[model samples]
Target: MNTYLRILSYARPYSRFVPVYIVYTLMAIIFGLLNFTLLKPLFDVIFEQVDSEVLLSYQNKPDFTFSIDYFTHLFNYYFLQVAEEYGKMGTLFYVCLIIVVSVFLANLFTYLSGVVLAKVRAVVIKRMRTDIFDQVSRLHIGYFSSERKGDLMSKMTNDVQEVENTIVQSLRVVFREPATIILYFAVLFFMSVKLTLFTILIIPISGAIIGGITRRLKKKAVESQQSLGRIVNILDETLGGMRVIKAFNAEWFMARKFDEETDHYAAVNVNMARKNELASPISQFLGVTVVAGILVYGGSLVLSGESTLGASDFITYIIIFTQVLNPAKEISRAVSNIQRGIASADRIFQVIDTKSKITDPDTPLAFDSFQKEIKFEQVSFGYEDEMVIKEVSFTLSKGKTIALVGPSGGGKSTLADLVPRFYDPTHGIISIDGHDLKELSLADLRKHMGIVTQESILFNDTVFNNIAFGMDEVSEEDVMEAAKIANAHGFISEMEHGYQTNIGERGAKLSGGQKQRLSIARAILKNPAILILDEATSALDSESELLVQEALTKLMQNRTTLVIAHRLSTIQHADEILVVEKGRIIQRGTHTDLMQQEGMYQKLSSIQSV
Candidate 1:
């Protein structure tokens, strides 16, 4: 229920449609009742030989009492009256005709209302998907490092679709179906409240049973959704590393692993469906029994001739009762769907509700230009368990490059991430030009730093758009200049579409060298005051490395740069080199000086040379 309330809050912006939807719902109900109510009179006129004066008067009456109401009702009366005039065969003909017309009009308006309701659902779901994407984009970087890409995709795709289905079904029941139950009950009650009361008693008992079953189904549904997310995550890992799996001959192993997760999903689904599927058949069975009980009791009452119910009235009750059955069944089915939607909602809301670990301070410093220095004062961090950076500190003078060289698990990358506030320091502080990093707006802080990681990030988009990603309203000339500096323009010009060529998903269509050059070009285009290069040239061959290195030198000039590289040769000429081990800075000096000191840096550099 709480989950549904949260989902409905999104519809607040479209509240104007609520009244319009209600009006349409009422019209559908009125038409449905007219469709059923016409049945009994036709039966009576044929079998009981009813009065012709009454039938003819109803056929042509201009009484203020009936009004035109609409052509459907008027035609319904006319068709029934004609049957009364034309004998038994004519009654059957008109009866079939009325059924066809009512069925047609009922279906026509139902379809129209469904289309309108779909529009409402589409708008709501679109807004929700947009909001979820925006939240994912804005979250702190650390979250993605620990989060599974496929699980997040499931939330956006599968989970949201579940919610959409529930909304569509719930609207039909909440709006249209309730109106049906009420209209039919009013007709039944006017005919005989004792019969109505009997049905009411039967309905609540069936509902109670369905409702209890639905609650258990909801628990199983939540488990099933989580299991499905795990399956997606495993499949993503398997497909993403198919090459590695084949090299190790692990196809059958992965297939077994996938089957395990899929089997768990199946088990949970079976549990949930066992309960939910019970609602429809049980309600149908109960409806049959109730109708039978009513018929037996109603017949006796009419035969006793002690009440208002005659043969016509008894037949009307049966018609209303049969019609009421469907709405009752629908309401139970809708409740089951609502429970499933709530399960998906819980997971989606979990993502939406997470507080970003890194957030800008309430009152932030806005820097016009970065000049003096970027400083880390007693910084420390950890990824859950062991500390990765501990009480380490450094200062980068304006326009100087600082290289962080370290053994594996030495926190070199974690330290670079701090400049953009990707993860807040567990203790102490980091500042740019005397203002704390956390005290600057995240967007403004990131605007000053450009980063390139070991994995070259590229979207399936035109080369021009990739270069211009970090900037707003980048012109063609700006893209050309950045590509030129990055040494990417020459090769890009030779491509079929030049700057307009689409880089297929993650630049898969481009060569390794081409992708690296484009990454450099994108960074160069941003032209940030600070730059982080995490082994940016590690993936390229020697020739590609040489080309990328040349571009890196040009891009790094006049920018405060932090470089993390396993190839100590690349950072040998940096102004300063800090050798990290465990979570502390074990050595800090010029590369030549570190070599003279014969420390961890010297040992690693010697290993690389050998």
Candidate 2:
């Protein structure tokens, strides 16, 4: 329940809709009750049972009082006057007219109340979803590596949708249902206190039964949501890896895996439905049992002439009491469904409550320019006790290119990752121009660096938007010039829409060389003071590699560049080369100097030459 209330707190500044909702709800309830209360006078008039002397005494206009009897007498006094002035048929028409008006006004106010609740529902969902998305965006890159993408996607899409459909819709049931039951009970008590007290005593039996059924529903609901997330994960992986599955002829394998998860998900929901569906009928049966008890006990009292309840008033009491059962039944069903919503809320708030491990420091050092060099001093990093980079130290002076050549899994990419603070070092310090990287704001620090990975990470967007990504107010000419320098302008112009053409997902519409060239164009447009290239040309064909390599050369000029080279021939002219092996730098020197020594760099160069 605390989690449910916390989710609703996102609907702030309730002054706009809450007060109006309250007004309309109250008006609807009052008029709806009047529809039942008017039944007493209606019965008395039809039976011709009005006492002339009593009616005459009430003719003096009784003073208004808080008791129900005062209002009843006040209504009867006017009714008797009309009864005397007109015929019996005229009085009947008059009473029927008032009932019709009361019914119409009751429904009108009910509709108005619904309108207000709709507005509140929209506002709450909009604010809650926006906050969840913002928190997910701010999380550190390592969080994604550890968490499943589909699970996070479920929190954003499926879980949020559950809150809207079940929880937000229940907001009215939370308030209006109880208020209706209470108001109807008040009318029942006014007619006969003894009968109302008897009804209240047995109501808890229904409550206890309903509570027992719904108590275990929350646990089941959580399991159901988790199973659904797993199903989503399977679907997402299958779609993303469709080509792999087909190439390996493993469609049956993938289909079997998905079928197992979805079957479990369907079974969980079936169990939940069994529990949720039981609450309504069980409560309704209990309500009918209570009504039967009232009929026996209250009917005996009137028969013995020991009770003041008239036949007409007793009938009205039973009518109002039966109406009370409807809201009670609705409340029971709502409690069952609310358990499902609370389960979803727990998943959503779990993500929103998570604090990002990477955040800006208070009073962080301001950094706008990069000068001199970037130095790693005895730097070491590990992922959960297994070291990837061990006490490695190097200095990358400005406007010079330093290349890292190594066998696979030798921490070349990990070492490059440290420069942008993607993962902070476990042991030592990395500084830029004499200032610690941790002391500067992350955004400001990253502003002067550009990165291109082995995978060409292009979006499904127009060529112009992809090149000018993350930048604001960039001119078209500037984008064109950058593309031209990266040698992408020729192919881009050949497309049907030129720069405005929509590239399919991850630039699937373009060739390998075209995609890499666009990536280089993006890096060149940023024109950062430092560049990190992680095997950027290794994935391309020989012809594609040549074009991409040419573009990379244009991007690397006048920048402090860190190259993780897979091909030894590409980095032979680097100002300095470090040969890394098994998380340690085995050798470091100029390319020519390293070639003179019979070491790992020489062996790797000889193999590539073959």
Candidate 3:
């Protein structure tokens, strides 16, 4: 219930529609009830059973008041007037005309209320989906690593879709169905109290049974939605790793995994369907039993002359009572659908409710530029009890270069990540220009630093857009200039559309060197005070390496640089070189200074020279 109400709360300004919708709905219900109630008079005109004394009494109109009695009496006053003026045939036509008008008004107001609900439905979904997207965007970088990409995608797409289909559609059913049943029963009781009371008792019994069944359906619904998320996860992994699957000939392996999830999804849905499907048949069967019981009980009253209801009035009561049954069945079905919708809602809220582990402080220090050196003091970081960076400390001053060369998993990249505060250290302080990184807002802390990783992160956009990414109001001339400095303008100018060419997903259309240079151009465009190049030219071929390395050198000029390199030649001219091994700085000195000694730096230099 909490989740269901939370979804409704997104429909802000409910005052815009709720009151008007209630009015339209009530108008529809009251007029619709008149249709059933008119049946009593319809029989009177046809059978010539209108009591002369009763007809005469109705001739004098009742004073109007805000009660059902006023409308009932007003309708009879006009009804008997038509009968007195004409014979039974004319009276019959009058009654038919009134019924037709009531039907028309009922349908017209129902449509008006539907329009209001449609607007609410559209607003509810738009806000709900937008909220999910915004929350996901603001989540810290680590959350993406710990959660499945496809499952998150499922919550944004499939889960929102489920709520729209089931919960939003139930808005009308939730409101109108119960109101219709309640009003219809009000009239039913007015005509035959004993019969209406008997149905009232039976209704709760059916409701209890249906409620029990739907509770179990909610559990199955949770399982079903979860299984569907895994199916999407498998599909995403399979699509993303098709190259690996084919290379390893693991087609059957992926197929087995996909098939298993789908099979489970199908089985769970079948179980849910069995329970959900059971509700309608049970409600309908119970409705029929109630109808039959009313006949035996109410018919005996009419024949024995123990009830105030005449034969015509009793028949009218039964007809109106039958209309109540349809809404009852709909209510049962709506409850089943709501269970599924709430299950999906729970999944969506799980993501939206997650508090980001990393956020800006309540009172952040001001930092617009890097004036001095960045210092790391006894910093350590770990992932779940296994330390990856331990007691690592280093300093890189303005207008200088510091390079970290190490083996894979030596925490070089992790150390670089700490500079940008991608992940805060588990212990110790990292201060920039005498301000601790945590004391500055993330936006201020990262604004003056640009990072170009080993893998160039390019979106599926035009070259100009990619170069100008994260910055607005960037003129094309500026983008072209930055590209020229990064050695990217040459290739971009030669393309079909030049800078306007749309690179495919992750720059799939571009070569590795081309992609790297574009990323460097993006960093250059930012003109950040500090640049972290994580082995920027390591993936390029010999010819492309020379081009990308030149661009890196240009981008690094007059800026503080923290570099991670696998190749020894790339950082040979660095102001200082750090040899990192097993999460610690094993050696630190100038490249030539380290080479003069017998160390990992000399050994690595010798191995690469071979």
Candidate 4:
């Protein structure tokens, strides 16, 4: 219930809707009760059973004031006039007409109250979705690495949908049902004090029983939502890795995996349904038992001449008491459904409440442009306890290229990530133009650098939009010029939509070369002062490499570069080359200088030269 209220709290400043909704709900309740309450008088008028003493009491018009009885007395006064002026059949016609109007007004106000709740529902979902999405966006890159994309996707899409459909829709039952039960019970008590007290005795037993059924519901709900998330995860993986699955002939494997999750989900839901579906019937059966008891007890009191109710009044009392059971049954069902919604709500808040490890300093240093160099002084980093990058010191000076060439499992990519403050070093300092990386705002620091990795991270967007991604003030001419420099403009022009052509997911519509070139064009569009190329041309064929290498050469001119090269020939002319092995720089020198040394660099260079 606390979780339910918290979800609703997203719609703040209740002044806009709460007061108006209350007014509508109250009016609806008043008119609906009037429809049932008039049955006694309706019976009397139809049977012509009004005694002279009772009719005389209503002869004088009751004065109106701020009380429930004022309306009742005023109504009876007019009813007496109708009985006197018209015949019994005419009075019966008048009572039925009053009931028809009351029913109409009741339904009209109920709809208005539902409209107010709908407005609250819309605002609540909009704000909650916006907040969760914003929180995900603010999380650091590491968070994505540690969490499953499918689970996060489920929280954003499926979990939010459940909250809206189940919990938000239950708002009427939460407010209106209780108010209805209270109002009905008040009328029942007014009708017979002894009978109402007997009925009230069954409440605690009903509450305890309903509470027991819903208690297990929350645990089952959490399990079911989690199982659904796993199913989605499997589906996502199967779709993304379909080629691998087919090549390995693992169709049966994936199918079995999917079946296991779905089977578990089915079982969980079936068990939950058993308990949830039982609540209403139990409440109804208990209500009927009470009604039977009331028949024996209350009817005996009237028959023995101890009770004040006439035959018609006693019957009306039973009718109003039966109405109370509907709202009670509705509340029981609402509690069952709400347990599931709160489980989903907990998943959503879990993501929204996570704190990002990477954030700007309280007093961040202003960094507008690159100067002298990027210096790594005794810098080391690791994941958990095992170090990935040992103490590696290097300087990438202005307008010079510093290349890192090494075998696989070396800390090449991790070293490049440090420059953008993607992850801070575990020990020592990485300074840009003498400012510690931590002191500078991440956006300001990254603005001067552009990175292109081995895998071209292209989105399912138009070629123009992909090239101009994350960059502002770029005109069409700018995108075209960047593409031309990266050797992508020719193919783009030949395509059906030119720059507007949609590159399917990860540029699947284009060849590997075309995708790499498009990614290069994006880097060229940024035109940063510092460039980090991590084996950008390694994945391309010889023909594609020549074109992309030429583009890289043009991009490298007059810029500080940190290059992680796989091909030895590509970095032969670098200002300095650091040959890394097992997270250590084992050899360092220029192309000609390293060729003279008898070490790992010479061995690697000799093998490639062969």
The candidate scoring highest on lDDT is: 3
- The list of candidate 3 runs beyond 4 A from truth reads none
- Give all candidates' CA lDDT scores: 0.83, 0.90, 0.91, 0.91
Candidate 4 lDDT over residue span 1-610, tens digit each: 5787789798788899899999999999989999999999998866767887977888888776987688777888888888788968778888999999999999999999999999999999999899999999988887888888888888898899989988998999978999999999888877888888988886668878998999999999999889888988999999999999999999999999999999999999999999999999998988898788888889999899888888888999999988888988888999999999999999999999899877899999888888799999999998779899999999889999999998998999889989998888999899989999999988899899899999999999999999999988889999999999998899999999999999998899998889989988999999999999999999999999999999899888888999999999999989999999888899999989998989988888788879
Worst 10 residues of 3 by lDDT: 78-87
Candidate 1 Cα RMSD after full superposition onto the native fold (Å): 3.3
The candidates, ranked best first by TM-score, are 3, 2, 4, 1
Which wins on lDDT, candidate 1 or candidate 3?
3
Output the TM-score of candidate 1. Answer: 0.91
What is the per-residue lDDT of model 1 for residues 465-582, given as tens digits with 9 covering 90 to 100? 9989857889999999999999999999998999999988889888888898899999998888989999998888999999999999998988889999978888888999988888
Q: What is the lDDT of residue 97 in candidate 3?
A: 94
TM-score of each model, paired residue for residue: 0.91, 0.97, 0.97, 0.97
Error of 3 at 595 (Å): 0.7
- Lowest-lDDT window of 10 residues in candidate 4? 43-52
Query: Which digits, one per residue and each the tens of the lDDT, describe model 3 over residues 1-610?
Result: 8999999998888998899999999999988998988888999877778998887878888997999888878888888888778878888999899899999999999999999999999999999999999999888787898998888998999989999999998999878999999899888878878878878887788899999998898889889888888988999899878999999999999999999999999999999999999999999998899899889988998899988899899889889989999998999999999999999999999999999877889999988778999999999998879898999988889999999998889999989999888888998899999888889998998889999999999999999999999999999999999999999999999999999999998899999999999999999999999999998888899999999999999998899999999898989889999999989999999987998999899999999999
Model 3 / residue 49 / CA error / Å: 2.2
The alpha-carbon deviation from the true structure for residue 224 of candidate 1, after best TM-score superposition, in angstroms, is 1.5
Cα lDDT tens digits for candidate 2, 1-610 = 7998887788778789878988899889888888988887788778876667767877877888998789878877778778888868777777888889999999999999999989888998899899999999988787889888888888888988888888888888888888898888888877789889999999999999999999989999899889888878888999889999999999999999989988998898999999999999999999999999999999998888767898888888888888888889988988888899889999999999998877888889989899899999999999889999999999999999999999999999999999998888999999999998999899999999999888889999999999999999999999999999999999999999999999989999998889989988999999899999999999999999998898898888888999999998888879999999988999999889998999999999889889
Residue 139 error, candidate 2, Å? 0.5
